[model samples]
Target: MSDNGHQNVTMITCTAPVNIAVIKYWGKRDEELILPINSSLSVTLHQDQLKTTTTIACSKSFQEDRIWLNGKEEDIRHPRLQSCLREIRRLARKRRNSGSPTSDVTSVSHKVHICSVNNFPTAAGLASSAAGYACLVYTLSQLFGVDGELSVVARQGSGSACRSLYGGFVQWKMGERSNGTDSVAEQVAPESHWPELRVLILVVSAEQKSVGSTSGMHTSVKTSDLLTYRADAVVPSRMEEMIGAIRQRNFAAFGELTMKDSNQFHATCLDTYPPIFYLNNISHKIISLVHRYNQHYGEIRVAYTFDAGPNAVIYTLQEHLPEFLQVVCHFFPPEVNGGEFLKGHPVHSSPLSEELKRAINLEPTAKGIRYIISTKVGPGPCVVEDPDLHLLGADGLPKKNA
Candidate 1:
């Protein structure tokens, strides 16, 4: 696998999409191992609107393992990064020792340079870690010519990351094994499983999280009784119901469960000592708007979920998108008139009803949201075949134009 004279360099680029957990994963039994206390379900948003792109290069001449995220170089000694690198190299070595002639032994020993960037915001509680780590593990596998179930390694980077390994509806099973080897993400349904399903991400705030998920989870695990109760008694049944809802395409059930699960997750946060506050005033109003909109239709037309931040992820179907967006616009006026506020699948113009406005009963707040990302279920991480798309140049460093 070593390039001749260490002059040859091997590079691979890949992209992965973000996922919104309807059934939130808040507490972890094993922090360093990143094993969740309960199973979680999420919808993988389309990569076109929200994704992370990563490029990795391996060469014998490189001095050390280095990584750059969203332009700045990040520490490669990060325990999670080391975990992924260690696992991938271990697998490669195992394969070689097993007499697999195709395994690249020389390249496996070479150091690597990784460059990653997110098209969307980072650390703003939008599952950027999920996409980033998924992309990293996938791109590394491609660069080293190693392939198989890498979701376990991805989970080491971020507990939620394992879900990004699959597209559409995914579930992170809280495996019972003490070693956490059984814990892995599995696809509950494909992207085409529900074509009408639509998702709208309300970017309430793009600022970095006041309390990171890792620390918040640790605090919750240490203090909150509610966390233990929910993980032990609540999530198992909810997981089963959620999977059934997706398999049967039951939107109402799915939406209700999503909202309730989100509420319960936040409730656990409140139950924690010193407590974490993920929802701001803006998030509260969005919740009211969603409920009022659903009340107007006498059904669960939309549902909202939050994870470690104030941003709201709304779930609905294609037909309801335009009207719901109109409701959003009425309550939260855009900063710029007719700006490209709505992204992803284009939503047709729709008029807001007087009854709906009265039902919402809130004054329009200018710029409550930075923007809205409209998307739906998307596929898992994919290899980028075009060399021009690579973030690193031939010298194994980020390109200036990248």
Candidate 2:
């Protein structure tokens, strides 16, 4: 302990990539706890393409604990965010009292200032929340000189966020307990475990989702009975198969289970009374085209999965990217006119401009999608040690472009 309240002030930053569940986590048992009805598996995307960078700094100069997301100050009073902070603080205090090894000692009573940013669009239904919460917990753990495991803190943020704590293939164990204390994520395998796997994210629409995933899951759990069967029977088997596929490097088995699980998850959503619409017409079109292409190829070359929104995540081998890109380009050509690609004429368009028509060879397709991001499996959270990269200023406020 020193003049800075307790000891030296320190900062820690971390970045984590978003993951798309090949075997989705559809329904929840406890909304507040974010405890899923069944276990789920996901493939962590490369951080260079899609990820969240979070910086957590502890200093006696800070007046109160605060957080900033994408350059905008957020209410730290939000229970979800507060719970994560409290849990990390508790762990840090325990470590400090035990005389544990720490990278940098900070004032024990210092307040934490956190700033986070996402590389991709937040509202595009691309699991931005997962990456955000994951990075927040990971960065805070390092900043507070916290010792012990990191998964527990990550779980308090979001159930899926726990999986993002690990890279490559991860599994969120739906532990058998009334309290979700044991329900955390573990790395099934690393990216190097299966070096050939690749993920191609199709940015269908950048429009904000009408319904959030938390709300949608709540609606499905209350209204849909199909969710019960899927959770009890379908997901358990799928989880087992998915884990085995990853362990043995069985792409064929992996692809089959992935597609089936995604379809079932969406099916349960549709079965919800007054069904919540996630995928639009354009999403279906992409699915149909992918199925047709795979059929023509006469082998299982690609796999597509969607989260709670219309964005499609296609998985394939690194070697097959060129062929896959060539076919995908024909269907979703670049948006040369008005940021819209002409896949076919819109079934109901106000009016098609001549300039728009010429972009896709005057094709009727209504510029079916937004854009495509080609990426693969990425690493776990990392700290940005560069001072210039800090998102918070010396005054404990959000820096520009944070």
Candidate 3:
């Protein structure tokens, strides 16, 4: 189409893992820059459990840049998405002008098409946006041969998503500047640093969250003055303590701080003018069960935290999984109705067939949970080297016409 040849287009695909904040980043000082009010820490989950795979391709034959999310074409006109694309393109242009060896500069300015898919359900409230934005930036940077820190690119996507660029424990530093240029994420420790830690993600319900994290945080910031106390007083001290505990492998201190921070963050959420409900009855019950189980053991064996939804994320030692699962199963068995435990069981059992009885016996009863994902701290975003995995076709466009 343009002066540059259309035959030689470079395509790159990248997969970025999702992260769950331990310290939590609740408020944003600047919406445009994605600057956080307080520094937060998170653990990047394994890609197999929750992740976003994004493919980016550029070619001179295309007319305009476009994006497709979860197989559905999205309006790329959204300001946040546009800001990310424009920033990445600026960096790419800089790299091209510098004649960097790593730059894959095409003779003509080309259009970029991005296609992203999340392995987990969109309704899961599992931080899909974090992985989506991180993967989008990572893939686009590679496609355009941009030479900049991944954290910088990641920050433009989502504040928490920036931490997804690093593996293991990541800390998002809330810089005290108006520009928000210094607010970036850095790795606190590697995944191998704490190999024995295990995470059990309990999917209580995968329904769409009524209040988005962004809107909730904005409300919390505007209404809750306690958030000020947290950002200025509580979090700073707890962050230092948690870092020390993590470094020394002090499970007791780690559990205490983790639970306290989670509670405080949620408290701030409730302190919002109209109040926000991030957790439901099931979530409270799970927390109570975990606390009771730990009290019964006379020591803290597990720690629980929640995000902006009802899902419960439990942290424990690798050796404690069996006991944890047993306790959870005891409390939450599969649902039963009309004496039919599993689905498709006959309503009337006049003769009571042996197979029906056996099936009923095998079927779990009253478990109000969807599923559980077992994972731990994992590595950061990585590029997919195989062309087969790319979401872009040979024409440098989205494979599904997304």
Give the Å error, residue 356, model 2: 26
List candidate 2 segments past 4 Å from native: 1-9, 101-106, 337-366
Per-residue C-alpha lDDT of model 1 across residues 273-388, encoded as one tens digit per residue: 99999999999999988997888889999999988899999999988989999989888988877567777778898997788788878888999988898898999999999999
Error of 1 at 167 (Å): 0.5
Arranged by lDDT with the best first, the candidates are 1, 3, 2
Runs in model 3 lying further than 4 Å from the true structure: 1-6, 335-365, 400-402
Candidate 2 C-alpha lDDT tens digits along 1-402: 335442434666778879889888877787777788889999998887888998877777667888888888889999999888888878877877777777344556778888899988997889898899999988887677675667767776777888898899999988878778778888899977988887777777888898888888888999988998888978888888899999998887888788888888889889988898889887786677667656765777788888888988888887666666555555566566633432211212243334423332422244566766777787888878787887776555677767
Q: After superposition, how far is residue 386 of candidate 1 from its true place, in Å?
A: 0.4
Reference-based TM-score of each model: 0.97, 0.89, 0.89
The alpha-carbon RMSD values of the candidates against the true structure, listed in the order shown, are 1.8, 6.3, 6.8
After superposition, which runs of candidate 1 have C-alpha atoms over 4 Å from their true positions?
Answer: 1-7
- Write out the backbone clash pairs for model 1: 1-106, 1-107, 2-106, 2-107
User: Each candidate: what lDDT?
Assistant: 0.91, 0.78, 0.79
